[model samples]
Target: MDLEPIWLSIKLAMITTVILLFVGIPVAYWLSRKQSILKLVAEAIITMPLVLPPSVLGFYLLLAFSPNNGFGKWLHQHFSLQLVFSFPGLILASIIYSLPFMISPVKAAFSHLPRSMAEASYMMGKSKTQTFYRVLLPNIKASVFTAAVLTFAHTLGEFGVVLMIGGNIPGETKVASIAIYDAVEMMDYHSANSYALILFAITFIIVISVFVINRNAVKSPFE
Candidate 1:
């Protein structure tokens, strides 16, 4: 069995999870703070991927990043960056597709937190930034972990969006999910089953961990 595809999927998931951790915290924090028309709009956009078809997102991204189009053409001419059907393109699409997974749980955690926490931190002369990082984030660590794990797991099984944007480029965009599809297409059930079993085991473990984490979080006195 070629483990390259599995390794590639793991690499992509790790990178995507890490990036979402940093990016999601700030966005989730902002979204949790208040309710407004603009916030609603932003939240809707962020959460759209949860329901949006991966192929649709992939198609738009493909057009946006295609060298034949304006945005892609500009990037190609100015910086010689090509995203479509490339590894970088896969990373970008994954990030967008998985944004809500990283943000929703963290935002829920943040919203459930007491206002007194931030207020007390402010009274102590801590900057909003400092308070958010030090006081609030510590309390929501479990949620953050859940979000990260969910994002990692989601990215690991990505198929439609990745296939549309990255296609199958061995050792590049040929992740485990795509490899499974190719194997099935060629009637190589052994390889396909191997990939499926591995992915199923990995995702199952990750999901179980999330449930355990959430259960513990709910039982924690601090929560």
Candidate 2:
């Protein structure tokens, strides 16, 4: 069993999770603070991948980024950047595909926070940025951590979207999930089982950690 696929998955998940952490934080925070039809639409778009089929997102992404036409052609001609069937494309697709996992929990946490927290910070003359980083954000550490872990785990198990955008290029875009599919197709049950079991163990641990974190977060320190 080549470990390359497993390692590639981990690398991709780590990169995707890191990127989403930065991207999701501001987006989630803004969404939490706003209330408008446009914000609702934007939230729906962000949440679309959760309900839509992975193949649907993958297909549209393929069409948009395929070097044969559209934005992909412009990117290729100008920047020499090819997205479809590449590692970078995999990252882009994963970010879109796993965005809600990173955003939803954090957004919910933000929404649940008392409005007075921000008001109190303002009374002390702290800027919104300062209040968010120094005052508000610290209170939702558990949710942020949970969102990051969920995003990482979700990326590790990606299949349809990755298959369409990245294809199965060994040592490149071939992640563990795709590798497992390939193994099963070849009737190599051993390799498939190995990949599945590893993913299972990792995700199980992640879920357990999430539960523990949430439990601790909700538990009173005095108790």
Candidate 3:
């Protein structure tokens, strides 16, 4: 019945996807190009969330953000930022949980491109930044678009991590996933089905849109 949770989930997904675009781009670029042995370790770290259970990650995060813990204490003392049981906590958890969704697509995008494009740009007196914007990004923009949509959808469906860290706080951390969970717990199948159906519809449409756009991009001569 309360729509606040749905809006909150949308807000969380949007913000998380936007931030991950910037963060994931650089990381994905690095992973795609770097050849050092340490790069393997770094990639594993970034992709760890994909295999790790959400509740496991959430449990550790909860401890890491507990006020009694050193890191949490430092955060509160210096920046007055409380990560546990707050909107900020949900953001942080979602970011971690959704990192691979954004990064993998971007990495694939960059990896699939020809190195000659970047090399030619460098030879033509373009800086790395310029090469990225002018020569590289345009060719692979579809992957980035895919990453954004995937991240948004993934964040919207999060439950265990958000629950462990944010605890279903209405108008704040109580996202649609949590709402469905609560509805089911209260023996309200209708409410649960409504939220679930809405989430499914939104995610389905987003994914279908991404596939359509990707196909078009691939078919386009400009791409």
Candidate 4:
């Protein structure tokens, strides 16, 4: 079995998860506190990828990232970056596709927090950034972990978006999901099973780990 795809999938998921953590955390924080219609619209747009058919998302991304389009042309001209059929392109697609998995959990965690916590911090003369770092983040550590794990697992299993944007180029865009499909198409069930089992095991471990951590987080000291 070619281990390259498995390695690529791990690499993609890790990068996407890291990027999402940085980007999603702030958005989740804002969405949890804001009461504007714009926030609602933005949340809807972020969650749209979750609801939309993967093929539709993939098609739009394909056009948006293609060299012929305006956005793609500008990216090419300014940054000399070609997103189509590249590793960074796959990572970008995975980030967009799995964003809700990261955002929703963190948002829920933030929403569940008491408003008084922030107010109390402010009363003590803590700035917004200080309150977020010293209080809010500490209380929501579990949720942050949950978001990262879920995003990573979801990206590991991604097919439609990666296939549409990545074109299954080996060692660059050929992640495990695409590799498994390729193996099946070529009637290589043995190799396919190996990749499938590895993927399943990794995902199962992550999910189980999340649940264990969540359970511990919710446990009472007295209990």
Candidate 5:
């Protein structure tokens, strides 16, 4: 096993999860409370990746990030930043691909929370930001953990989007999923099995641990 791809995959997942934590919090919070038509549009777009084929999303992203295109060219010209076949590109794709995994659960947790609690916090003179950090968010630690793990796992196993956007360039873009894919394409079943089994074990541990923790944990104090 080269392990470089595996490490790269882990790095992508970690960074994606961290960014989504910040991204998902506000997104989910807004979605949970908003009643506007735009909220529906936003929710549908956010969740589309869950059901959309990775290839479709990847293709659009490829066009959007192509250096020949305006936005991509502007980025390269102004900042010399390349997204087409780089780690930063991989991270961007992973974030969009994994957004729902982080947002949905967090939104569900927030939705299930009592609205009166938020109102009470507001009545007591706490700003929404302060209330979220101190009173609203800390209470939903379980959902937050579940969201992070789900996002990390989703990014770890991502393939098609990564392929179309980043391609398999070894240390540059070849993640574990791409590595296993290459091994299978070469009829290297042994290598494929090794990679597959490792991924299976890691995802299994993550998913099972979430269930175990959720079962044993108490409900949030704010709830």
Candidate 6:
């Protein structure tokens, strides 16, 4: 069994999860509290990935990241970076595709926070940033953990977007999902099964681990 793609998939999922944690935290916090219509619009935009066909999302990303496009060209001119069919491009696509998995859980957690806690912190003369970091975040640790696990698992199974934008470049963008596809196309059952089993095992572990952590977190006195 070719282990390379399996390793690549893990790498992709890990990087995507880390990026989503930072990006999703702020977005989820905003969505949880913001009353503006723009928040609804933004939520719709982020949740689009969950509803839209992977191919459709991938098509837009392909065009947007292509060097011919204005934004893409500007990036290329400034950084000499080419995203098309590259590892970084796949990472970007994975992050976008897996955004809702990260955002929704964290948003729910943030929304579940008691308003009284934030008010008490404010009454105690804490700034907004201080209240969020010192008060709100500590209360939502489980949700953040849930978001990271779900996002990582979802990113690991991604096929359509990675296939469309990544083009199966070996040791670069050729993740396990794409490698499995290639194995199937070649009628290599053994290789396909190996990749599939590894993916399944890793994802299963992640899901189980999330539940375990969540259960323990819920039972902890800190909560």
TM-score (all chains, Cα) for each model: 0.96, 0.98, 0.96, 0.98, 0.95, 0.95
lDDT of 2 by residue, 1-223 (tens): 7989988999999999999999999899999986999999999999999999999999999999999889999999999999998999999999999999999999999999999999999999999999999998999999999999999999999899999999989988899999999999999999999999998999999999999988998999899
**Better candidate by lDDT, 1 or 6:** 1
TM-score of 3: 0.96
**Residue 114 C-alpha lDDT in model 5:** 96
Q: Can you write out model 3's per-residue Cα lDDT over 112-200, one digit (the tens) per residue? A: 89988999999999999999988888888889999999999999999999999999778878899999989999999999999999899
lDDT for 123 in candidate 3 is 96
Please list all clashing residue pairs in model 5, or write none if there are none: none
* Ten residues in sequence with the least summed lDDT for candidate 3: 214-223
Better of 1 and 3 by lDDT: 1
Candidate 1 local lDDT, residue 185: 99
lDDT of 1 by residue, 1-223 (tens): 9999999999999999999998999999999997999999999999998898889888888999899998889999999999998898899899999999999999999999999999999999999999998999999999999999999999999999999999999999999999999999999999999999999999999989989888987795866
Deviation from native of the Cα of residue 205 in model 6, angstroms: 0.7
Candidate 2 wrongly placed segments (more than 4 Å):
none
Winner by lDDT between candidate 3 and candidate 2: 2
At residue 39, give the lDDT of candidate 4: 95
Q: 57-147, model 6: which lDDT tens digit per residue?
A: 9999998988999766778999998888999899989999999999999999998888999999999999999999999998898889999
Clashing residue pairs found in predicted model 4: none
Q: lDDT scores for all predictions?
A: 0.95, 0.95, 0.91, 0.95, 0.93, 0.92
Model 1 worst lDDT run, 10 consecutive residues: 214-223
